[model samples]
Target: MITAENLTKRYGAKTAVDDVSFTVRPGQVTGFLGPNGAGKSTTMRMIVGLDRPTSGHTTVGGTDYRHLKAPLREVGVLLDAKAVHTGRSARSHLRAMAATHGIPARRVDEVIELTGLTSVAGKRAGKFSLGMGQRLGIASALLGDPHTLILDEPVNGLDPEGVRWVRQFVRYLAAEGRTVLLSSHLMSEMSQTADQVIVLGRGKVLADAPLSELVRSWTTSQVRVRSPRAAELADRIAGDGVTVTSAGAGLLDVAGLPADRIGDVAAAHGIPLHELTPTTGSLEEAYLALTGESVEYKTKEIA
Candidate 1:
């Protein structure tokens, strides 16, 4: 398990991470999410002792990462895929890393096969493509078969099959009662892979909870209504903050109103209704709703 208590990182006058306190428990995948400048990378660095915190501290299995005699055996980290030596082959790179922790040569071959890099294990790191480099990084991270894993954008350059493989692999590790903390920009994949989510914005944690609970509490419930007089019904229901948008011909997407209320309004106005579907909410919508204000770069829509 990973525990961070009031973790803060500062660079001169700018604060990268501020008073961030969260617990990443074992046997689950905890997603670390944020905007471009939301300090996700900095927090991860602090967790692994790559970057020192300004005020607070972080721990892996209740011990600082730097204090671990053999960090690879206790915790695995994949912050940058390009951190390997360019002149070494994939197998040689893993062997060098394994050598540090007294890991056997067979374990290196096992991780190479496990990460699907067996075919290119003898290839030089400099010639590997971005996706292949990511695989090599994963292979190195799993070389020691550590109990805790911290991966940042693990599927950045992966294909569809590779992405699925990573999703399943992390989930498998979690099922084995290992701690897994993942960071990614793909909301759809995160929704499918992560059991819990921690959202950061403006160098602070905006929300942290189970994925289902975050979706349920942050996003607004909407009802999709299809009727002949869609525009009329929409106008009738448009009051205060209620929103109604036309999806297509005779289809209206209504928000801030329940499905039953929309049905009653249509029935009272003698409008023929074809469908009434309630959408609970989605992870993307919930993320935007929670971090909309914390966005550092805003783009104006072309109207």
Candidate 2:
């Protein structure tokens, strides 16, 4: 498992990560989510000891990345997929990473096969596509078969199949009792992939909980009603527990009540409706709602 306690970083006057603390447990996928310039990359760099923290501590297993006798074997990090030398072949890059920790060439072949880069393993890394470069990066990370994996935007430029392969790879690694800490701006993908989430905004944690818990805390399910007498229907629906608002022309959005119950109430009041449908909130919607007031860059809603 990877644990960070009040980890912070500062470069001159700007505070990048401010006392941010969270733990990534083994046997599950924990997503690190934030907007652009939310200090996610800075935090990942601190965890791998590439950037020293200004305060607090970060640990992989029981030791910091620098303190570990074999750092690569303790934690495999892929901060930048393009951090390799361009002239070398993909196989040579993995070979060099393996040699650093005294890992064998047999293990290099294993990671190449595992990452599905066997076909292009002999080609120069600089000539490979973005997808293939990402695969080679993963191959380098898996060279030591480390227990902890920290990848920042692992699926940045992949196709659909590459995305699926990454999703499965993270899950399979966790199933084998390894820790995977991944960060992305894609909330929809996180919803389908992560068991837990750590949400950040402006160098601080906003929410850290299970995915379901975050959804429940941030948003609510609603029912939409469309009728000719929209105002009167909305007024009637706005009683004890339910709150109603105008959604659009001749449409009302009602919350704090299920769709079936709303339908029953509307029918009992002799209300005419052209549509009555349940609208489930998306994870993206919930994320925006939670961080609406905290956006670093706010433009008017185009819609």
Model 1: per-residue Cα lDDT over 1-303, one tens digit each: 999999999999999999999999999999999999999999999999999999999999999999998999999899999999999999999999998899999999899988899999999999999999999989888888899999999999999999999999999999999999999999999999999999999999999999999999988788889888898998889998799989999999988888999888888989999999999888999999999999997889799
What TM-score does prediction 1 earn? 0.90
Off by over 4 Å in 1: 229-245, 260-273
Q: lDDT of model 1 at residue 200?
A: 99
lDDT of 1: 0.94
lDDT of 2 by residue, 1-303 (tens): 888899989999999899999998999999998877788899999888899999999999978888899887878888889999999998899899888889999999999998889999899999989888888887787788889999888888888898888898898999899999988888888788888888888889988898888887788888888998889887776778788989889988989888888777779988888998887777788788877766787777777
**Colliding pairs, model 2:** none
TM-score of each: 0.90, 0.89
- Which residues of candidate 2, in runs, are more than 4 Å off? 224-236, 245-252, 266-277, 297-303
